[model samples]
Structures are given as structure tokens and as C-alpha cells.
Target: MKDTTIDDISLISIPKIKEVRGNLGVIEGDVIPFEIKRVYYLYDVPSDAQRGGHAHKELYQFLIPLSGSFDIKLHDGINKKTIHLNKPDKGLLLVPGIWREMDNFSSGAVCLVLASQKFNEADYIRDFKTFKSFKR
Candidate 1:
């Protein structure tokens, strides 16, 4: 796998259609850099709770705020950056080998995630030290 940097992360704009009832945002497989194999959403999280303190070996993820706002802290083993996901029409594209942590969730925040791979515990590097060594 290629070493991913902070620059590799991007904000993708999904097509949104405005209507009288409500707005609709569409996301297709080709809209992102990778194919979608799994989909999940996080909701009803406590204000003090955090999520995702690990790095993936090959998985790719696209994250969006389906409801409220939250912040994602990303580290490429050398550089760190924080990205906020607050809009329903925008999504964050995350590549492999990057450590990430999500926090600062607003009330009723719903985080929708599109993943390129299925659930596999072996693909995850939960240790920060192991992730740094893997980047080297």
C-alpha cells in the first residue's frame, strides 16, 4: 500500500437536490475513490464519548454528517490535522494507514460511514506505536 498523508484526505461533495419537502443527497460508488462494500452510521453518542482510535491497513472510508456536526482528528504518523464534518452534502474521504479519532459531537449527531471493505478485525492497527512503525 502507498503511504498516505494528510493531503490524501479530501472533502467530497455529494449531489444534492432541493425540493419543497426536504433536501436529498446522493452518493454513488464512483463518486468516491473506492468502491463501497459496507455502510454504517453512528448516532445517539454521548457528548463526552469518542470513537475511532486506530489505523487501517487497506480499508478506505468516506464519512459524512447525516445530522449534526463533529470533528475528525487525522494523523499520518508525521503530520496531524483536524477536519470538521457539519454539512449533509459534504463527506470526508479517508485513505488507509492514517490514524483517526472522532470527537466533539454536537447534539443528535449522526455520522454516516461508507467503507470499502467488510468487517475484518485483522485489518485494523489499534496501537498508535504500531501504526507509526508501519509508516516507517
Candidate 2:
């Protein structure tokens, strides 16, 4: 029984070229079609700790689970959806005005995130209550 608020989240599967012993995953312009300006990863997290408890005001993000699995709870001010990221060849496309939280991450999970813009504190809506108000 988990409680989530956002709903527009979906699993995005990227194209993968397979080989004999190795596989290559690519996110081309035709694949994602968004200008990825920022790239980052989340790692070295404690077992009971949770990450990503904020909402972006204008930043669109693509989230990929490079290793292990995790649950992405997304809220679009009205509806809610929980997206699970476990495969490296897929990612989650999160649009702006969506409140998101990442939790239930397995041990040694690596989350790769791609953003449409650089770091900006004004672009993030940290307070959940304020996010709700802005949702309208």
C-alpha cells in the first residue's frame, strides 16, 4: 500500500543494438528528440534513505536505471502514476509541473538522469504544499 500523487509518468524504451557479447544503448535525437543539456547519476545511497522529493517548475527529465530497480512516483497535480525503472535500455520521460519522488531503490541501484536544462533553484518547487497550489 504505497501512496503516490502524480500520474502522467510512463516507461520509455530506448533502441538497443545487440551484439555477441555486448550491447550498445543509444539515445539519439530521433529517439528522445529533446536537447539533453544536463546529465547526472545518483549513487552510494544508504538502504533506508530516499532520493528525489521535489518537483521541477520547468525542467524536463529523463530517468534511467543503469543498475538494479526503483519506483518513480509522479504527480501531475491531479492524477498519479508510478513508473518502475529496472532496465538500462529504457527511461522515464518526466515533463514539467509534475511532482516526483524516487524510492524503494534496490541495493546498488544506479539512476542516470538527463535534464533539458542546467541547475536552477528557481526551477525546482521543493515544498509539496506549494507544488499543489502551483498545480492549479
Which prediction has the highest lDDT against the true structure? 1
The Cα local distance difference test for each model comes to 0.93, 0.81
Q: Highest TM-score: which candidate?
A: 1
How does candidate 1 fare on TM-score?
Answer: 0.96
lDDT of 1 by residue, 9-108 (tens): 9999999889999998988757898888999999998878899999999999999999999999999999999998999999999999999999999999
Alpha carbon lDDT of residue 119, candidate 1? Answer: 97
C-alpha lDDT (0 to 100) for residue 67 of candidate 2: 90
Count backbone overlaps in model 1. 0
- Give the lDDT of residue 59 in candidate 2: 82
| Candidate 2 lDDT tens digits, 31-95 | 66479999999986665777888888778789999999888877777777777789999998887
